[model samples]
Target chain A: MEENKKKSPYKNKAEKDALFEKEFMHLITPLYNFAYRLTFNEDDANDLVQETYLKAYRFFDSYEKGTNAKAWLFRILKNSFINEYRKNVKQPGKVDYQEVESYYNSDDIDEPITQDLRVDSVKDLIGDEVANALNSLDVDFRTIIILCDLEEFTYEEIAKILDIPIGTVRSRLHRARNILKEKLREYARNMGYNG
Target chain B: MIKTITHLIHRLIGKKEHSYCCKNCINDLYLVLDGEAEQKQEEELLKHIEKCEPCFTRYQIEKSVKEVIKYKIQHKQVPPQLIHSIKEKINGII
Candidate 1:
């Protein structure tokens, strides 16, 4: 009886492998997008996505069948981004908007020598310049913008992803957007637009 | 006389001119813009916007900021070589 139970056709390792492959294949694009946005570098993003997939495959048995597979995979990738990938990178200090405002307000700044700067339209402003500004933001601000604005994740989901309170998610998203707006405004000013 | 007095009191308190969206509602405009407001709050905000000019303008600015940021993110294309490399890696694994 025990031998017959062990020999059941449904228990085949190859069948399980096939099932995992089918499900895992469908999640690759979103996983790649998430990693790319987080790392902002192609090679690093690729590596992160690859590692996430490998880790998921190794632990496939632990995943519940009917639950959200994408969220589970994203949780893994987010953890990897925080614990492993971000460890080697240098994070900037918190932005003090007050200090930034005071510095820019100082009388030592030179006035614009020419008023001939051309303003680019929203379409023209949406490329590398925007990406560079996003990359330049501190990781905290960048992650909030990525989760809340770009990914359109709910504040509750973002709280789970970042392991912060929901209120923190809301407040951080607000601060992040304000900072991004300030940066974009600066870019607009340089292009001679009245932001 | 009593009805006239009540009317005068209402006008004196500026209830007729007051916006439906109060300070708290204005503060929550970002959440509304994100589509993250709870259902009741969302409904209330919509009703408020229908009557209030200042709050309506605030809503427009928030909406514009969201659109501009979204446009910026959407326009950023992943490099072709990166796509090729990812495909190659997936094929190798398969």
Candidate 2:
């Protein structure tokens, strides 16, 4: 009986279904958004979210109740995106972020020049332009922004999700926001706005 | 009185101009904005932000940027068809 109990996380199929729906189902929309932002393609986002759910369900027994279901789901989707889906998307090929990380790490002054824009200007910016500015950042920077700002994850949660230290999460996020500000400033310049 | 004035003049001519370091302020300001910094540290930075000019401007810009990102970014919803398909796949596994 003990062996059987260990094998089955839930007493029955009904309990499993109830737990899964109660804990995980409501997160489908936010999960889809995370997937969509990462892929920037609707069809691929659908496929990624589907794959994420299938894997989540398969591994449900391992997940503890009343825990961070959203972070767990996001971790699965992120892993799948890196391991499987990214290959399918056309790209110049894999750019090792290790080099990028190292370069950024080596400098104490890693913050990009993101100043000079008036706070009033930031408020005046439209949604699409802001989105484009965010989307234009490197994927590493972009992913951190989505997780930190968009998802509103804590530094500790983000560290666990990305498998990096809390310090790295803070530093990377700092650089990402600076880069985004720089991107927006350049956009304004292109539009003939006097910065 | 003369000694106090001499110390003041020395401090004024010292390697550091003011006690608040803008470089350190910029770094710590990120922590303060994240709402995760230590309470004591947060209070200190808050006091400093209230005083420093460049740091105050910097804080306002960073805070505004965060606000814009939170509310201004366009959010796309999950497609109804995708939800249906995800449910179908989940059922298939069981």
Candidate 3:
């Protein structure tokens, strides 16, 4: 029948609700953490995570079942952040991807600093300094670092989440880490770590 | 005689020196750390790290940085209310 064809594959609403709860609810902690890091504010992070979940629930039909729910949710949250907060509030002028790419490429300064043992060791560095240094980075760089280092996502996963090629993920992560190391170097030196 | 035996033992345990500087291993350092490298590349990278000091140090530092980020950044706990609210929102809709 036409009605039968329109119906979802789910046997009942109860089954759908239970499955959604089991799979998606558990990801709240990680989702919020990611949201917080991206927005750097409690209110924004809360709104972001809420918006992400709302969107996910609305589009639940499109989500392929039995796949990576975490990655799926993460992708939604990341895209929402880019479209909503990043474009509207952060930049009045449109974010020029080309300009950002060229800016990253123009800086060859990170090469010498990282190779020369400028920071000595990050072992003794305090949490505040690390957090500061991390937050200081541009959102693009920071997102990659958070995804790769903090969330421990693989490059391929990151490439999928960021909608870029695997090669871009590699190069961007390399550049991001180098920039992070440079930022940490100043803090390390301030802490009197001379190596 | 004892030194020679110890050296032989080290080599037996896969402690042989790396003769050539491998560009692939060096380039894929973070890839290996992030568990993104292919199986064969991972093996080659581990071997290269064992023999190369610079690569080993680089690996250590990157690993340490990862750990630090995971440890410190995770302290931002999500409030209990937020979870309850999200549940409420979902419950209302479903």
Candidate 4:
């Protein structure tokens, strides 16, 4: 993305449309999902996604053609969330990641969390059971899980998307998944699955 | 340290479930799971898990966690109005 910013814009309107449709337009679903996960409100998600598209279109010059448009747009939406919507977010209890990063960084790694969670238990988890577990996480953790697990971005891409080091990406992902698994285990137990 | 305290707490809170995952394999578990392990490390992990039940189960549970999230947390239907609005807005810009 940093490299793309230095390259020239699309050659002409037709070239612009072709790239936009091929790359940018095809990604709206995942973009909307990403937006919705970040915002947790349909109206706000719609507005954020629309605003991202508009901004991406307006600054289409900064985006070199045929690049990782997904990461580019995700970075834009993530920034927009932090800048524009973060202040307005009424959902309390989200912690900024400075504390999380420091706390997670210090750990030399203990046993993995959720030692009791089993394969059968995980299989029994379906739909909202899993969704709620993810939603309940801190936004930073939730974002990493979505990026690494759902979106399947490589660690390098995730680092670019989040603007953190690759090592940080790995540790953050490790911690995030551990927390997620712990939640799923708790939920499964509550649902009466012994495994 | 914090790790010891966590271990102590887990011991007190519940009976210790047998851990198939040891500390060493735990590192490989994630590196392998995330597809970030080097080719040699990945090969070692594959060979190790075959002989190790705990690490194998640990790997499966972690993989399933990712699978569940990807499958279950759905992408909402993009409101047609939102798509239409974005297109119209872009057209106006062009």
Candidate 5:
């Protein structure tokens, strides 16, 4: 089976089109999911998906056969999202890490770290809270979380999609996950999850 | 001084999970919990979790948080009319 796939000449236009039609339906859910994660809204996701498909169809000839079709599609969709949607959204102000570190360091050393402190009494960690927390993250952090955590892209794949070094992808993903974990922990505490 | 050196050595070589599991590993834990960790790193993290309780607990917590978020996102369904309109637009473009 693997050998057959290796030798297949689905590289030609007619064969490619037939294969695309046969396989495109399988991509709809994934494409929709990608769009939805990026836009965080249904209408925008739909629009993005439509645009992605249109663009994908136009550039169909450019695609290398028997390669990662999904990643290729996602790359196109992500480019569109950044160019069209993200460009319009005003980015949050940058954090001054030095100041933040100084502020923390200035605090009393004897003050207990709340390694075990309870905050509130809500049981369910609602989605809005999660979304809001994710939204609060910088665009870099947010994109890493969406791609790595939600979409399950590999570090290598994410690097390709975002056009960054693999080291950058790893570091950003780590920082992003840490941020989300901290926020979710706070949210969990607010909702009263003691454990 | 010897005792203090021993203490420092214990702390340095402690059973605690690495403070730097890298962002890729941390984020990958979510997919791991969802039973979707990729081949190579999946084995690596699985071995790490076998001995690292802190990271294991962290994995559980991250998974739970993801579940809550996933539930919320799934609940926010797009309206059928909107979906229809988008489909119409898509067809028109094609």
Candidate 6:
């Protein structure tokens, strides 16, 4: 049975179309939003979303019906973003490691460590501040925050989507939230939220 | 000397569940707040929070943050044209 399953071909065009329409089309808005946040540009986001959908349609047969179509589609989109978009965006900057190492090895690395404990209650954080804080995060942290908070995906779903263990998801989410809180603390304090 | 005495006194007084100073419990608070902790663990954590003021405050703050993000991010209007084009593009492909 397992051998037969391995040999089985993907869905036919008609079936693929039906499945795509029924199980996957509804995710366009959220998927595009995710893409937009990741790329932070409209055209790039659009391209990523379009590419994701095309790839999803092409690989429709492997998807298990009646079981988390959203996660499956998200997984495909995330892979497309990592493989296609991230590679292209990061490829142009080739840093010289020798120079970087020499600088770090010298006595000039004045990395300051300070903790800001000035605010309480994120309740006063406005929408724009929230968006800014989210956007300012590194991609890994931002992705986890978006998945867990904005999209309301469970940790298990996030683990599956990001292809990481659940423990990593929890730790990353904790770190991400801490970072976001620190970013928003200034805004909260500015609004005179003492508690 | 003062910090060491405080630590020794705390150890002698036996850590109370009502004390909000347990770092371990506070670390697990987010999972409980997010509803990711298992039922048994959830009950244990909730019980701990019931007695711990700091953990409860942390819980409320984190919950509000989650709510704010969810409310703000999803409120952006997805362009109708974008949706239409996506449908068209998918149809054009297969």
Best of the candidates, lDDT? 4
Per-model CA lDDT versus the true structure: 0.63, 0.78, 0.76, 0.80, 0.62, 0.70
DockQ of each: 0.18, 0.45, 0.30, 0.52, 0.18, 0.29
Per-model TM-score on C-alpha atoms: 0.68, 0.86, 0.82, 0.85, 0.63, 0.77
Candidate number with greatest TM-score: 2
Ranking by TM-score: 2, 4, 3, 6, 1, 5
Across A23-76, the per-residue lDDT of candidate 5 in tens digits comes to: 454566767876776677787888887777667766755566666777788888
Looking at candidate 6 chain A, the ten consecutive residues that score lowest on lDDT are A107-116
Q: Which residue pairs come into collision in candidate 4?
A: B20-B54
Better of 4 and 5 by TM-score: 4
lDDT of 1 at A142: 75
What is candidate 1's lDDT per residue for A1-195, written digit by digit as tens? 344333433366566556766777667766777788777777778788777877776677667666567767888888998788766665564355446444433521222211221223333465566666676777777777776776677777788877888976765665566566566666767665654
Q: Give the TM-score of candidate 6.
A: 0.77
User: Which residue pairs does candidate 5 place in steric collision?
Assistant: A122-A191, A174-B23
TM-score of chain A of 6: 0.77
Model 2 segments more than 4 A misplaced: A1-7, A88-93, A105-107, A110-112, A191-195, B1-20
Candidate 5 lDDT by residue in tens digits, B5-89? 4435657887333332344555566557645567877888877666655455556555565555555544344445644554454
* Candidate 3 residue-wise lDDT, A69-139, digit = tens: 88899999999998898767745554565577667767632344365333246877788888899998878
Worst 10 residues of 1 chain A by lDDT: A108-117
lDDT (tens digit, per residue) of candidate 6 on B1-94 = 4434554576688742222345566556777767777788788878766665555656666777788888865444567777678667777774
What's the lDDT of the predicted structure labeled candidate 5? 0.62
What's each prediction's clash count? Answer: 0, 0, 0, 1, 2, 0
